[model samples]
Target chain A: MLEIQNVSVRYGRHQALFDIAAQVERGKITVLLGTNGAGKSTFLKALGGLVPTGPGASIKLGGVEIAAIPAHRRVEAGLALVPEGRGIFGKLSVAENLHLGGFAHRARTDEKERLERVLDLFPRLRERMPQIARTMSGGEQQMVAMGRAMMSHPDFLLLDEPSLGLSPLLSKDMFKSLRRIASEADVGILLVEQNAKLSLEIADYGYLLENGHIVGQGPAEELRSSPAVLRAYLGEEVVPA
Target chain B: MTILVTGILLGGTYALIALGLTLQYGVARIMNLSNGETLVAACFSAWLLFTTTGINPLWGLLIIAPLGFVANGAIYLGLLRPLVRRATSQGMLEVDSILATFGLLFLFEGLMHLGFGGAYFNYQFLAVPFKFLGGSYALNRITAFGAAAAIALALYLFLYKTRMGTAVRAVAVDPEAARLVAIDVGLIAAFAFGLGGAITACGGVLLSTFYTFNASMGAVFTMKALIIVIMGGVGDVRGAVIAALILGVMETLVASLIDPGLTLAATYGLFVLILLFRPQGLFGGAAG
Candidate 1:
């Protein structure tokens, strides 16, 4: 389990996240739903140590504290983040990018096996290995980003807006892949997404954020039907009559 | 034919010089205006070793390259790392690094002038002429070209084939993404800066074998290197090698066919033309 507590983030004088606490369990999918500027992205970055958390913040992965480590060290600690815009190396070939994904010491021993598993999860990537990552379509690039993260042998995978810029059908397929990844790889997934309906359909647990605060939390099924979730994220039209 | 051969030999050395600057700027994000001073310092070291201790410049390289690496690493850690930390953005860091390295260029030049007494220095090693393609060339020039080619080839393989080298290139492509992959971006940058210094020092040792150099002449090589780097596109290794060869051939043709003094003029003229026309580089895509 990855547990985060008292996680606050500030950029200069503007506070981005305020006293946010969350827990993500292995072999399960957890979704964070929020509107833009609700600190969803910031929260994920803080967890990955891409952003500095407040002094009192504590992030524990499998009973080990990891919040004070640097971003790369956090990857070595088995936390991988796929930030917005995919964050793939545009100039590098997909093969090289995937090879680098297994750079952390924890991933080194079973790198070949991990590569096989990642390729199985995203079969399209197998054909595009020699191509530069940036030249690929949005869906394909997303696959590369996810596959790259998976290569790190991460205990918990954090993804921000994985569906953004992807086609609706592709997004559906991506969510399906996420479900498979969590169950088969035995990895925890903490996803920050705007597509509430699709994410909740696949998630085991959910958290709702508003103005950098967690306004609500519940099981995915409960949040899917909660009045506040419908009003805030799903909208009145998404509510079933 | 002689001009072509001579130009190619000269180009081989130029490629080594430009490769160092490209690595320093591309991966380390340092403009490194003092790049030529490292070259000059190596040249003087080669001269001193050969004249005082009867050491061949080729053998002197074994000593000079590591010194360059350590000195350059110290400079990055002590001087440039602070600038890198304080600067808020890439543009700000570029400005800061340029200013800092420019100051270093002058400082090194002045110290070299005081120490070396502002005299032109050269050493004769393997000065015999070797016949090639119906023309004779200095054996030292050929040896220098051979060494440069070997070094360049080794560097290319390291970057393209090895895991650590790919990490260095990864840092160049996108540092933030590199962090996601668990690469130590800062450590890689420092290593690249130091390796660049070592390569540049190698170029200096090669040049000192055949060419005369003085303390103040470092800026000339720096300018030539800057021109090649810009002409080839920043951070593009293949482009740098090609551009250096072109510059060498053009400079030689101009010196042989026209007035020898117009070589610099011709070099800058080409620079202006490239800036106006193919600023992205001969082989590079549109500038990012």
Candidate 2:
């Protein structure tokens, strides 16, 4: 489980987030939804410790305060974030990229097996193991990004805009895989996406974020039907799934 | 014909100098403008050992290699390391390294001036030129030059063929991902910096044999080596050597036909022209 209390972030003199807070449950998918510049990516970056938390900010992972943990160390602490840029080394091969994902736990007994497991999940990667990642198609690259994160065997997985630049059909494919991954593995995912409908369709629960604060939260189906959620996200009435 | 042979051989030698610099800038990505300074500085240690005690600078290797590595490692730790360390989140911290190394250039020159005095000194070895064909080519000199070429070639093989080499490439490609995979990011950087230093001893010993040197020589060779690096495109060993040799031959031809007075300015002018045409050097694959 992951918890945040009174988190605030500043970029130079501009206040980006003020008193933002949320919780991601163990082994469940939690979707964070907002318009562009709503601090969605920033929140995930804070969780990964890529962005430093402001004073009085407290975050706990597995019940220990980790607001000050560095980004790489946070990965070592089993918190993995697929960054907004996807952060895949463009020149490196897919296999090499995944190998780095397992870097923090490389000395663990099952490291090689873990790599095989990731390749197993995304067989397309196994097929093009030697190809340069930068040359891959956008959807394939996204899979590589998610698969790279999966290689960490992280307890808490934070995905930021994983579906951006993807086709609607490909986006649908990605969400289906996300649902399957959540149901099968004990990995907790805090998926941040602009496609609120697609994200809520896969996630077990969802939160509506505005100006860096959670304005509403509930079960996926319940949140999908709220007048405010419909107004903010759907731009119309929510049709029953 | 004589100038051509001389140009080819000298190009080989220049490649040797540029090779060490190429490794540091292209692979390590530090833009070590101080490489020529470090190479020249390493020569002083050899020069001091030679002029005083009459020890063959060959034997001086035992001292200067480690000293060069330490000196390089220390400067890297002190100056360039901080800039390179935070390059990830900040995204390609480019101008910072140029400033750090430029500052190091003055520091090294000042130190050399203080210790050895600014006067140019002749640093030569056994003048045993072997006779071949109809004339003599300086055997010891050519062989010393050959050693640098051999070193650059061997380094190319080592970097491309070995696991450690691949790891180094991995660091070059991506430092953050390299850390995530459990590579000791600091150790890799230190090892690389030390390597850059160690190779300078090789270049220094070779250079000290053939020329008189002052603390001021670093800037010139650094510029030439940089020209070679840029000319070859960053990180390509094949490109560095070809560019160095071509420039060497071209400079030799120009000096023989035109005049020595124009060599420096003309060589540099050509360097700028080539850069203007292909900002990526000959045979460029990776820019960094």
Candidate 3:
């Protein structure tokens, strides 16, 4: 399990995240839902160590404290982040990007097996290996980003807005793939997304964030059926009286 | 035919020199103005080794290249790493690195002037003329060109084939993304800066075999290298090689056909044309 506690982030004087606590279990999908500027990205970045967390914050991966490590070192410790903008090396070929994904010391021993698994997860990438990542379609690039992250053989994967810029149909397919990846790879997924309905549909647990604070948390089924979630994020219709 | 051969030989050396600057700027994010001073230092080292210890410049490369690596690595760690750490953005880093390396340029030049006493230095090593394509050329020039080509080829293979080298290129493409893949961006940048220095110093050793150089002339090579780097595209290895060849041929043609004094003029002419027209470089897409 990956546990996050007392995680707070600040950029200069602006606090992006407050004291947040969350837990993500292996082989499960945990979704974080929030509106824009709700500190969803900041929360994910802090978990990945891309942003500095406040003192006393704790990020534990498989019972090991990892919050103090640098971003790259966090990857070596079996934590990978697919940040916003897809974070794939755009100028490099898909093959090279995937190759680099296995650069962590932990992943090097089984890099070949990981490559095979990644290709199985995103078959489209197998054909586009030689193409530059930036030239691919938005959905395809998302696949590359996810595929690249999987290449690290991460114990925990943090994804920010994985469905952004992807077609609705593609987003559905992406969520399906995420379900498969979590179950088959036995990797914990900490997902931050704006598409509340679809994300809750695939998630095992859910956290609702507002103004950098976790306003509510529950099982995915409960959150999906909750009145507040439906009105705030699902855009429930209001009929005339 | 002779002109073409000579230009190509010259271009080989120029390509090697420009490549170092490209790596330093592209991967390390440093616009190192002192790049040519390392080259000059290598040149003087080659001269001193040959004159005193009777070591061939080709053999002197073994000593000077590694020294270049250590020296450049020290500079990056001791001087530029702080700038990199404190820089808030790419533009700020560029400004800071340019200023810092600009200062380094003068410091190195002054030290070389003191050490070598501001005199043109050259040595006769393999000065025999070798016939090629119905024209005669200096054996040292051919040898220098051959060495440069070999080094460039090795660098190309290292970048394209090896895992560590690919990591370097990955950092060059996107440092933030590289971090996601577990690449140590800081370590890679330092290595690249050091390797770039080594390559540029190698170019200097090769040139010292045939060309006359003085301590103060480092700035001229720096400008020429900068022109080639800009003309090719920042961080584009293939483009730099092509641009350097074009520059060599053009400079040779201008010097031989028009006037010897107009070579620098022609170089600037091409620079202005590149900046005015294809500022993104000959092969690069629209500037981001």
- Computed on C-alphas against the true complex, the DockQ of each candidate is 0.89, 0.29, 0.89
Model 3 residue runs over 4 Å out of place are A237-241
* Backbone clashes in model 1, listed as residue pairs: none
Query: Which digits, one per residue and each the tens of the lDDT, describe model 2 over residues A45-142?
Result: 78777678899888888888878866667777777788787878787788767766766652355778877777767778889888899999988998
The interface root-mean-square deviation of each model, in the order shown, is: 0.6, 2.9, 0.6
lDDT of 2 by residue, B159-217 (tens): 76654665666677776655544456666777777777777667777778776788788
TM-score of chain B of 3: 0.98
True contacts kept of 2: 0.38
Docking class of 2: acceptable
The deviation in Å at residue B39 for candidate 3 is: 0.5
Per-residue lDDT value at B16 in model 2? 66
lDDT (Cα, 0-100) at B130 in candidate 3: 98
lDDT of 1 by residue, B1-288 (tens): 899889989998999999999999999999999999999999999999999999998889899999999999899999999999899999999999999999999999999999987889887899999998899999999999999899889999999998899999999999989999999899999999999999899999998998899999888898888888988889998889889999988999999999899999999899899889988877788785
Residue A146 error for model 1, in Å? 0.6
**Cα RMSD to native, each candidate?**
1.3, 3.9, 1.4
